[model samples]
Target: MLRATSRLPAGPSGSRGHSRPGRRLRRAVVVTAVWSALVVVAAPGSADADPGLRLSNAAHLAPGVRYETFSVTASHGTAHGHLLTVDLDDARMKIELLRPGTSGAVTGIRAPVSRLADARGAVAAVNGDFFDITEVEHPGVRPTGSTVGPAVADGRPLKAAVPDGQRYGPALVPGATDEDVLGIGADGAARLDRLRLRGAVVTPSGTWELAGFNQYALPVDGIGAYTSAWGPASRARASCGTNDVRAAACGTDPYEVTVHHGRVTSASATLGEGVVPRGSVVLVGREAGARALRRLRIGDPVHVRHRLRATGSVPLAFAIGGYPVLRGGVPLDGLDETAAATRTAAGFSGQGRRLYLLALDSGAEHDDGLTLGELARLLRALGADGAVDLDGGGSSTLVTRPPGAAYSTVRNHPSGVPERPVPNGIGVISSA
Candidate 1:
C-alpha cells in the first residue's frame, strides 16, 4: 500500500520534489489513493490510522542513527518532513542540547542548526526551542536570544524558564507551563518533564528567594540570578513587563548586586550589563524584590545557590525547552487544530530507547505545514508514545551529516531564505 519513490540526494534542495500546480493536483490524487490502501496494512481497531505518510530516501548516518524524508497528504495540501531515528541503546549514541557558543555561554546569539551541529560535532540536529526573537514591545532593549524554557547541557543547568506570559511563540495549551521540558536522563532515556528553579540569595540579613536564573524575563517582584553562562546581553529587559502581562510597562525601581567569591562586590540601583565573570553572580531584582536586595552592602558576605529541580527521579543529563503535544500515544486536548505551519518536534518510544526528531518542510508548492493536532497524529503513526513540539514556523529546521561526511547539511527547506538562526537545538552525537 505504501508507495516507494526513488531515493533523493542528501541536500536541502534535493530532498523535496517540486511540481507545478497541475502536477501537484495529480500527485494529490495519487496520494489519496495511496491513503486508501494503508487501511489494509494498519492494525485493525488501532486508534492511530495511517495518515497517508510515506518515508523515502532513507540513510544511516551512524550506528543506530537513521535519517529519512517523509511526505503526507493533508486536507490543506501535501506536506514534506524530515525525520531522524536514534537508538539510545547504542553505546556510541548520545543526545545533547545545541546552543550557539561552546564556551559555556547559553544565550545572546542565534545560529543555524547546521552551524550548531558542526560546532558540536553532532551527526544530526533539529531546532530546539521558541525564543525571544524580537523586541517590539520593549523598545531599546535587545532581544536576548534566550529559549522559553529551561536548558541543561552536559548535565549542568544552564538556564531556567521565564514567566509564562513572557514566553514567545504560540500560546501554551491548558495545563502546560513555561517550565515544561524534554530531557534525557542519566539512565540514558528520553522523557518529557518539568524543571523548577530552586534557588536562594543568602545575605547577612536573611535568605531571599531566587525566582529566575539566566532567563530573559523574571516574575514580577522576584529576584533573578545571572552567571557567566548568560552572555553579555543587557539585563534591562528582565525588569520590563510583569509576570501576568508580558507587555506591561517596565518597572522603574530596579536593583542589581554583584557577588564575587562569596561576597558582595558591588550594588547598583540600576540593572548592569556585560558578561558575568566566572565564579561571580549578578542578582537583579524588581519592585519589592529590589527593595530586599538594596539592604546588602559592598563586601557583605553573600551566598547564592541555584539548581533545576526535576519532577522526575532520574537526574537530567541534557534538557531543552518545549511543550508536550502527544502523551501516552494520545494528543492533548485543546491543541490548535486550525493554524498550520512548518514545525519541529521530538518524540520517544520503546521505553525511551528510541528518539524521533521531526521537522516539516516549508516550500512554496507544499507549504501547508501540519497543525499541532495533525502533527500529533503523524507522530503517533510514526510510533511515538510521547512527543513535544519545539520551535516552528521559520525556526523549524533539520540538519544531518551524510555517511562519512565531514560536516552536517541542512536537509529541509527552511522558510527563511538565508536560514534563520535559532537560540538552541537538540543534537545527536555519536562517538563511533
Candidate 2:
C-alpha cells in the first residue's frame, strides 16, 4: 500500500554547457544520490536500543519521545497486547479507536482527518485514523518546543523522517533553530520532563515505524445473559460487579467487572454498585438475556485468554474538519477513511491475508500514561503491522466468555461499549 513519489527532475542535454538553473539542479541530483547511498549502507537505524530492558530497573515504559496516534483493530475480547495503566500526560496524550464495519465485514481508516488543533503535535494509527496536526507541548500548561525535551536517549536521536524544526542542545530539524529545544545533553540525560514534536504522521501510526501492534478476533461476549460456551464446564471464567475480575462484590450486575481464575477471583475497579446500560456488554451470555455491548476495560495484569477469529472486513475513518475521511483524502475506496468508519458494512474486497491475533492486558492503569516505544514493541509481539491506541485506564474493557454464562458486566470508563457491538473481545484473559 505504499506509494512511490515523482521521479527526479529531468536534466538538460549537453552536459557541460547547461544554464545556471540546470547546473544547480545537476549538482542537487549528485548530492541526493550520494546521500541516498549512504542511508542504504548505514546500520539498521534503530531509533534507540529497547528502553530500560537494558537497565536493571526502570520507572516507566517510555523510550523518551513524544507523538500523537490513531490505531484501530478488532481485538474481539482476546489479549495479545498489554493495557497497562502508566502515565505520560493525559491532557497532552490521547488515543482513539473504532471498528467501522457492518454485520460481519470490517474496514480500514484512510483519509486526511481534520485535527482538533492544539500546540505542538503528533498522530499515529494502525488501520488508520485522521486528525490535523496543530501542535504538541510537554510537562507544562503552555505548549511550545521550548517547554519540550529531546526525544533522543542513549546515543539515539530522532528518527530519520523527523524534519528540522529547532535544535535545542543537540536537536535538529528543517525549521530547527540553534536556540530552541530543551534538555538534550552530550551525556544523554534529558533536561526537561517531556519533549513535544510539532509534526504529524499521515498514515497508520505503527505501520511506518513497522514496530509493534496487536489485533484479535474472537466470539462475541453477550450482555444480560451468559452463553453456554462459557458455562461451568468450560475452562473460561466469568465475573460481574467488581473492578477486580477475581474478587466478589455486592451488586446485581452492578456495572462492576471481575475476572476469575477457575473458582477464585481477584482485583476490582468498581465505579459504583449499579447495573450498566442495556447495550454495554457482550460476553457469550444466554440468548434470552443477551444484548448489545458498549465498552471495554483493560484494567490490570492477571487476565483471561480466548481464541480469536477475524474477517478483515472492517473499515476505519477519521473525523476531519468535522467530516469523516478515508486515506486522509488520498483515495482508496469510493468513500474516504474519515467517512468509512461510519459507513462501512461487512464484506470489504481485498485479497490479502485476512487474520490477526490481538493481545489485551486488562489493567495497568497507574496514574501515568503509555509510551510509543512500549506500544510499538507490544504490537510487534502481536504480529501487527501497527496498533491503534484506544481509550484506556478505566475505559478499557474486554467482553468474552463461554456460551452458557448468564451475563457480562461493564469494567471500563468513558463509554462502556464501542458505539456498536461485535462478535468477540481480544483480551489477555487469565485465571486466579
The model with the greatest lDDT is 1
Compose the digit string of candidate 1's lDDT tens values, residues 325-394.
Answer: 9888778888877777899999998488789999998767658887787787777777778899999988
The CA lDDT at 51 in model 1 is: 51
Candidate 1 to truth, TM: 0.88
> Candidate 2: where is the Cα deviation over 4 Å?
1-369, 409-432
What is candidate 1's CA lDDT for residue 419?
Answer: 74
Superposition error at 1 for model 1 (Å): 58
TM-scores of all models? 0.88, 0.20
- 96 Cα displacement, candidate 1 (Å): 1.2
Which runs in model 1 stand beyond 4 Å of their true positions?
1-50, 414-416
Candidate 2 overall lDDT versus native = 0.19
Per-model C-alpha lDDT, please? 0.80, 0.19
Q: Write the per-residue lDDT of candidate 2 for residues 1-432, one digit (tens) a residue.
A: 111122212222111100111111010112112111111112477333222211011111122111111122211111222222211122222222222222111112111111111000112111111111112221111111111111121222221111112111111212222112212133221111122222211111111111000111111121122111111121111111111111122222212233333211222332222222222211221111111111223432222222111112221111100011111111112221111111110100011111121212333332222232233333333222322232232223322222233333222212332322221112111110
What would the TM-score be for candidate 2 when compared with the true structure?
A: 0.20
Count of steric clashes across candidates, in order: 0, 166
Q: Ten residues in a row with the worst lDDT in model 2?
A: 209-218
